[model samples]
Target: MQLMEVCVIAKCTYKSETIMFSVSSESSMVDILKTLCLRFRGLQLGCFTLRYSVPSYPSCFLETDSDLDLMRTFLLISNEKTVDILVKDLCGISEYSGDFCVNKELIACEKGESSCSSTVEDRNEFLGRSKRASAKPLLSNEWETYIHHVGQKFDGGAEEFRLKLCKYALEVGFNFLYAGNDKKRVVAVCSNKKLEGCSWRVYASRCEATGSFVIRTLNNVHTCAGRIRESKSKMMRSRVVSSLIVDRIRAKPELKPVEIIHEFKDYYGIDISYYHAWFGKELAKLDVHGDESKSFNELVWYTDAVKETNTGSLCTLDCEAGINRFRRFFVSFGGCIAGFQYCIPLLFIDATFLKSKYKGQLLCASGKNGNQGFYPLAFGVVDSETEENWTWFLQHLASILLPMGRVVTFFSDRNQGLLNAMGFVFPGWPHSYCYYHLKQNLISKYPKSGYGKLLQDRVINLFSRCAYAVTEEEFKVAMEELVIVGSSKVKAFISDLSRDHYANAFFKGMRYGEMANSLAESFNNWVGVFRDLPVLPLIEGIRQKLMVLNSQRRFEAEKWTTVLCPEMETRLCENAEAGRTWAVRRSNSTVFEVFADYSVMVDLEQRTCSCRLWQIDGFPCTHAVAAILAKRDSVYDYVECYYKTDFFRKAYESPIFPIPDIGKGLGSNGSAAVVCFRQLQRGQPEDHQQRGSKFLFVVVKVDGILNVGVDIGQAFNTRRF
Candidate 1:
């Protein structure tokens, strides 16, 4: 009488998973599916559950009642697509006889729960299986204990709270491990790794414990102070590494000298090597942070250069302290000055250390060319007169003049390493020690010794002789007295001094004195005209200084012809008569060639010279102007070319580019523009049918005609009419 009920329990196993369920007589198939879905939250029973879960049922299906509807819905949901399942019955059956039983225990009877527990236990079951999950013990075994302690310390769950703490430590290279009981757990771990420029020298496995919740307690320990301490530890290690780099660089005897690559700026980001201009203000005094600070911007660098130039070729470096931080800024633009190509060769070099400005260490060089006057060439600052320092200076100088050629000679006070480095840099050219340096050293050795006087006189005579000594014996005899001096240091010095190849090479008619560093001191004279001033004023002052030098050289290169007068005209006529284009003047006439090709006239009777080149170039007696008047040539034709622009240009050319921002990627919530458009469209839902700007974009013609388009999904698509 129970409507001929039939209970079909399918006993089947799928991959060791048993499929079994008891079907009720009164309940519909839909009800059974719904019950099954509810019983196993983790399982997926298709739309069979959805059919019974919803309200309305089809009239054709209602005639069969509960079980039939349940079966129909099951068939529809399991056999049809998910979308089609919704169409089968938007609402579920309204009436059901009795409840359907579809518990998980009903399935998987073959494999006992014991077997499941022994093999692969579910997450919740595993959590429950930890015999001591709730038990309070004396010590915790894992990081979970600390996590639990932290949570308990803060009165929160150990699971959700521990992840954050663990993540933070891991980010900085510390892994958390557990070690205490549940009653009073500990959050502890050990670190032995170096991450983010840090040293893990304090390597020790340790532990910490807490009770209940402890987020705040842990967070307080992980403050910025903690980060900074960690960061500083890393930096200390890094400094050691940096020092190692400097040492390794110094050790390589075969390595080339260090070059002054480019002039750095303080404020402005752009770095210009050739033509440079900068404007900066006093953001802060030199040691705003403290004496340990040495930070500086591009502007500060320019300002320093200006000030140092005014201070006579010497200025101390300044910057921020702690960790040796330099200024930070963006590189906007960079380009060479128009006339840089014409100015460089006259580079003056000097080296100084942190000690007294005058005494720490110093090296200087001067250069001269066919058309230029005395010019400063190279200089360096170093801790001492050590081989490394000398090599550093020479290498840097060589790099600055690499394209110029090694034929260029250098003059300096004879320091051992300086001499060695010079030979390494320009092996083919002469690296001469200054005569004054030699003379002074000798005097130091033999203060009142008649031999010292005699030696000095002999040296002066040979140099003034205007020619190389006829024999090497002449130099020996000249040094005969100093040679007799008792001091071995003096003897050795003189011996090295007389070697003719090392220190004495310049003394043997090598034109070494002509390359003396005296003019660099003179150039400093021109710069010291303005040194102490604020940033803007200093820059302005420098501009004037550059202009002065530029104007003077420009004038010299173009004005020497005017200095020659009537006698030159007469000689030209005579030469014209002789069918010659140019005439050579005689030396016997009271004429001297002054610097810059300008001749100075000297009247024999008056003994007065008429040109200023003699004063500027430090060359007198030979007046080109006087010679021109007396039908004789002048010596000015051989004046050095330091005044030429070409020498200045080569000294400056460095590039600067901006550092890129490497932060988070932009706009994660869809394209910014698209999101805005969607928001706008939602605001005008009443006009949803309208296209164009209302939805995406609209183009309007100059005549006011509108072109509308919908993007659909393609971003660049357009429709116009």
Candidate 2:
């Protein structure tokens, strides 16, 4: 007689799944369970052992082939209506195998309820039951939600995470199972959602490493299911979300929270809130720029490092008197000192507002080198552009400069504090207001008057012309035009303005024909991006930029072929070409008269022109050029040293050494180190920067081993080396 065959339904309450498989009365229980596990592609029956638990029948473990048939007889012949079958993992979580269709929709289901349609919305959760195993979509979220409810759902407020994880596996189409106790089952799902088109099965497992448990995806769990498709579980992991947020932040720091929420739905197939992305970005800033307060505290060491690395570099970090936080500070490395030697004597000092927790102004003292590019001499951060702060800035400049015996002209706006400070600090030096700044003040003070734009334009243009006028005659001509326009108030203001400081005719020899502080303004723009950084980072960033500026310029100069710098050569060529129509008649071997529309005297011997261009700019004017060419003299010979390629090269010869962090988390104001730039003169008060050997950093051992670094050279030491 053939062995009797009977169908048993194994219902999985978690996935809302049930399977029907025929079993023979003679078949061993082991074979029955093995066959059942093999049929369900998405189920990991290995984690569970089959058992027959019924009221009449003592809970019997069908551990052997004989036990299967013995239980089949009881189901058939006994008066029991059904046999309560249970699949349980010895360790709660049975092993998972894709070789069987465990997590997938009933591929062989000639039986019960099936999974949701493959045609769910991109935003929909795609893993639950809808209709019978024959067809149709999974049930609504109400019924599907129970898939997340493991163990006893209606039991108090507690729910099992194993079933919850089972729901996640169903959602993502992963081949895994929760194989622990229902009360405290460990949920193990496929960690790598990227598993697709592969023969191997992988599950997420938490294992101990270095005394800490880290989640890892282990492969080698084989699955007969064709190829697991790529899908993300609706279950969102904290780490996974954070990591993706970090990537998006680095790619687009301006990415908003709403975009992140949509990103989870679109790219990740998961849902996240807007606030999550916002808070995540806040955390990301720390990862990218570091903690702001910690960086501020590190400025002391940062300053020390600049002095140490750049040798003759000078830096001063002064905090508020009582609060002992950054108030006003200045730094000018050795390269700045060396560069200034070949630069024009004019210094443009100005201040721009800083955007930080503490409102302040960034004061920059900049000059123009032979290349006519901004030569940042020093930078200071001040609470405001007060007289004391400006004085402090100029005083630091004076300490190194006065000892050199060279009085440098200063070009600045008529900032009351800066003007007052300049008069006191460099009393002998000529201080001029930036005419452009004056023009701005004029425009701001006198808004659109009854004078239409035309008149407004005329007044502004006339004032601008006054700044560039090479002679009092030229300035007076513009001034008369302004007065002709009938703005008596403007005329009076112009008349009161000292031509020496604002007019090219007056500041001719003193300021190199420069009447504006555009150089300082440009310098402010040069390090504008770095100003937003914390104190230590801002200083380090500025220091790094200077190094790049020095290197790039040096490299550029090496490529120049002209005796004069590129810009200077261009100027001379233009001027010489314009002087082509000049009528030059030799007065003597060294003198000539150039009547280029106007008669002017050019004395080559004195390196001067009656127009004063040659003397004031230190470069031959068109008149001087015409005279020099008339006598068969080289025009290059008439140019100033300040315009020479070699002089420009000298300005960048000293290196702006790289500054680095000596230690981590060096907080602000807690430590102190004295820094000097251009060391001070001996027998003098030692708190100033002086002209000395370009770079010398000396460190004295403090505790026989550790070094206390200081910048000291004969130039700044009270006791000479």
Candidate 3:
């Protein structure tokens, strides 16, 4: 049987709709009713019945297949190409009841009224209807250029239309309020419509055919004396402003509220209050990065994800017992742990304040790479920088470092709690104090007004000379000068502090020319912008930075042809140039004496020079370079292994994998152990704090973990690492 198209008109008390469906001779009333239920949402199969409509015949229900067949046959006999049917509700009486009459002459006149040869205005009206049927929502970038016009259509329903209308009002320097607002219809008028006789208004209703909101009438002209001030307008809400600034906030998360106010005044010629701008900025940040409170709850999943993607990574989350509130978090990536073995055997530790809602401190441990670049080892977040927290952090750090059986030296500023923690955790390890901090402390004790600026500079310069002196005689000469410049109080202060911590000559361990904890300070400055973020995003941001740094350095190292890094190679060249005119006397194959202004001994076997520069800096000094030239050996070969290109490659070989976003509802495929602790109450001292419970974690990796378990999908795959 040939297929035929029929229009089924469904009517109710609220509204009416017409839907077209294809049917054949085999089609039954049951099939037609099923199709109608599917087409019209919220409709049930047994609640409505189809009725045949004809001008001459009595209106009757098409109840069975035979009735439908008879109706089709009658239509065919009458030479009609279309059949009109009505759907009536079974429970309630439909308004289209009783005899349904059709006037043929009236229908012919209506058809003639809308013919192709109609006037230009009528044809434009028909085209507007067609355009309204297929309208799309405006894009984010198109809002600046979009114009509000009569008969404009929005396919995103009433809420989107209201947002666009509000934006239009702000752009055109007018304010409006919704006179009548609902799901199906909306009416907006100027705020000064009644008082000032402003004629600006807009009316929109949902189209039954297209299910879109179309602007049926709009009066865009306003007769007001001046533009409405956005600062005084009720329509300039924080949510509306957030919608306008979300893209900018996402691009630069550190955009301040004051900057937003200036941007609005300069770009949009609108003035916004400070509080509204601040609240709007907060809302935009919340939209860009999820809620901060909810992010705390996601720590468990984030920890598991970190361990899964980057194997051997150590991530711990400490929360309050029973309350489940976050207290502390620590993370040490596998790549960093593996890479630190190739860096210098010295660590710079420091603590900085976190600018988040729940104020805390960020403790970091950094190392110096072969090229004198910053190498982050581990970091933790705690309530404050207390001895207990420092001890806890050091204990975890020991788990990674102690296994290598290499003696490491620590460098840091003088913090009493940190010093005590260092003594408690690693009793025999050598610790170096920052000379810069020591000099600041000495200057702080004496009043600048009493000593005068010139005397203070003289004392500090002598103190620096004493700290950098290579021989005992030189140290004595510098210390005597410092005492003469200052007073006996300065000598007493110097005597109280240990020389092994800051003085280069008396230090027990090799510092490799690093006298201060500047590496940690550099790291703190690098993550300054992220300190204000929540705990999870702050850590994630640091991880992303490290990931990019490693990848970039690794690629740059691949193109190198020199023995040492570029920086170390240049230093070696400068040393060789400085000692070119010196005289060299060889005592043996390993020992030599180089004479410039004075004579110094250089030993190749021990890799040391009497000047102490070669042994302390891990490279050939001027005297050693001159002796090596006398022996006709290359200076690059005499350089330490740590300064070679191979070690630099090893430091950044392992990759830091990207963590999956928890907002997408991705589950973890690996298991994690979370330790819980109860934070100390306010006014409580840290000395009385107790320990938290710890758990053992097991590692598990499942096949297709990235695809099924923690897949961020295509959205995160395109993001730069």
**Considering every candidate listed, which one attains the maximal lDDT?**
3
Ranking by lDDT: 3, 2, 1
Candidate 3 residue lDDT tens string, 396-470: 888889987887899998887889999998887889999888899788766687547677778889889988998
Superior candidate under lDDT, 1 versus 3: 3
Ten residues in sequence with the least summed lDDT for candidate 3: 692-701
| Runs with alpha carbons beyond 4 Å of true place in candidate 1 | 1-292, 295-365, 369-374, 377-384, 448-473, 481-490, 501-516, 521-552, 555-721
Tens-place lDDT digits, model 2, residues 145-225: 322111222221113233334333434355553333333224343434245433332222222232212213333333334
Segments in model 2 whose C-alpha atoms lie over 4 Å from true places:
1-283, 320-323, 445-451, 484-497, 662-721
Among all windows of ten consecutive residues in candidate 1, which has the lowest summed lDDT?
275-284
Query: What are the lDDT figures for the candidates, one per model?
Result: 0.34, 0.61, 0.72
Candidate 1, residue 451: how far the Cα is off, in Å: 10
**TM-score of decoy 1:** 0.32
- The TM-score obtained by model 2 is 0.60
Alpha-carbon shift of residue 314 in model 2 (angstroms)? 1.4
C-alpha RMSD between model 1 and the true structure: 32.3
